[model samples]
Target: MLKEAVKKQLHEGTVIPAHPLALTSEKKLDEAGQRALTRYYIDAGVGGIAVGVHTTQFEIRNPEFNLYEKVLKLAIEEMEKGNTPDSFIKIAGICGPVEQALAEAEFSKSIGYDLGLLSMGGLNHLTEDELIDRTEQVAAVIPVFGFYLQPAVGGRIFTFDFWKRFADIPNVQAIKIAPFDRYHSFDVVRAVCHSKRNDEIALYTGNDDNIVNDLLTTYHIRSGDEKIEKKIVGGLLGHWSVWTKKVVEMFANIKDVQGEAQIPSNLLTLGQEITDANAAFFDSSNSFKGSIAGINEVLRRQGLLQGNWCLLEKEKLSPGQAEEIDRVYRSYPHLHDDEFVKANLTKWFDERQ
Candidate 1:
């Protein structure tokens, strides 16, 4: 039923889309670049996209909202483009302020997005009532896909009660779960997915580090383990899924039952590799800023991303670090060549016998 639901969404413009690893302007989308980005996903067989329209000082006090306006116009243009299947999957994204997000949400609906969500970044901890009120405001406008990420990555995380409140909104179809504490991913996925009042609300993982494991494991069990082994969450949205085409392909292939018997090895290998990579780039290994920079570089080298576009990552790459990234990932080769991507992808899903 869950697989069918996901497939239905995929067929209905439900692309398990990727998000920005970094919001910095080191590289970014221009008119040509945005179209190129849309094409990149279509080529990769991805269904849709979620562009981040960022804003600063959203503390609800300084009072300058609508900061993400230009970004929204760009993303909305892509969303609005009337096109074919290879052209249109789905477009999910975030706008800065609640009011602006509401307008953007309505626009996304008007433009035919499968799902629309608001970024919880710079969001102050609203009271349960306030959260519900705001959520209903958006839910009434569009299919409210909740961006329920913890604020570990320079954003604010909400409380369980806050989620319970938000989920109560009728159109709250899903939540993007990227918790600061890894275990919170498990916890929130459980709490949100199993809510009697929120059964319709799905949990999608945004933590790239946990993508394979997240998509492969079961998290429905609260206290015990009947072992819901078929996986619950839909997919990664942030760093993991952005340029990791091979990983997504591996995932798409893994969804096939005939491929299930062979999934464990590749799943483990891929999960571990991604986890280690993210850790080195995101967690203890370096600053979150550096990780996004590294990921963008990886995407550029792989040719899935445009070199002209860059996020304004707070961390700067060292003199040789950029070259070193190319040199290091060359051994893997999947990062660059499509033939190599296909080869590794085949090994992961087909040759595992």
Candidate 2:
């Protein structure tokens, strides 16, 4: 059985940022910086966070085996100190080969994480049937958060039938839909509606390009003899990491009127604005050379990061990428929470110091 406490926490209106890694000059985990980042998110009042995921440069897996354990342990420790452990769901990304993913899931459970954000990296080569078998194996060890990551990153598009079968797995709590394409996006919603486990699996939009639109949509599906409607509850996103406090406030406002008679017209307008901002920050114009660095640059400006650094030196922001970010940063003043960061940066950075 799934933990009732966790299940209750896993509903609509939950905003979970795929937490980024804070790196030091020597290219190791910056413990205090990472801790400060965690505290910042908790204070922002996000429902949860996913650590050691793509935003955190899962590349750390190649050189630093023990860092993931350290980060998880420290996050748990800090959360306990905050006295709001039950207020958030702590999810760890478990990717790579099936064996490695299983081992990471096992570790996340031992450290008190609520669920495993499961991704099939190497298994992308497997047939759909074979992939389903592997997914079952991981879900058996711990509750799984299915991932429909976008192809722009390391993600590949899967068949709609793949999602329908995956949803039938009892341990799957939620799926992060980051296809970034509307056609493929609907494919996920369609599959969930057809599944026997429709009510069991929650859908979170990781579609940075369509965040507000995804949240505003109401999905209608036939559950046996009855018709049911669902909304993309919230998001687990890399875009969320930079202007987080603003994202939280926006979520609260959207949730307040999500099922009401008519959503405010401004919300639709905001959707277009958010997509426009994402195009620049995500480097869509330049084919995404500095996606992670772009987020770091925002934090750098807000004094949250030492500099816009990544684990790999080659990952630096391209000239066009930086110019695009500057344009968006100037264009969309309303979308950022820079004032919030400014007010709290002193105390938060001191905690790290």
Instruction: Assess each prediction's global lDDT (C-alpha) against the native.
Output: 0.52, 0.82
> All candidates' TM-scores?
0.73, 0.95
Q: Write the per-residue lDDT of candidate 2 for residues 122-166, one digit (tens) a residue.
A: 466778887788789889888999888777677888998999999
lDDT of 1 by residue, 1-353 (tens): 12344435542222365544223243333444444444454445555566542211122122342323444454455444424454343545644557877876776666556566666665575555766687777777777667655555555656665666666668676776766467666656555644554447666666656766766665436524333322444653655444445655666655553225445576577667666555543433443544445655655554444551333324445445565565535544443335543443322222121
> How many clashing residue pairs are found in candidate 2?
0
* Candidate 1 error regions (>4 Å): 1-7, 10-15, 19-29, 53-89, 197-199, 222-230, 240-244, 257-263, 280-284, 302-315, 318-324, 335-353
Score residue 273 of candidate 2 by CA lDDT.
86
State which candidate has the highest TM-score.
Answer: 2
**The CA-based lDDT of model 1 is what?**
0.52
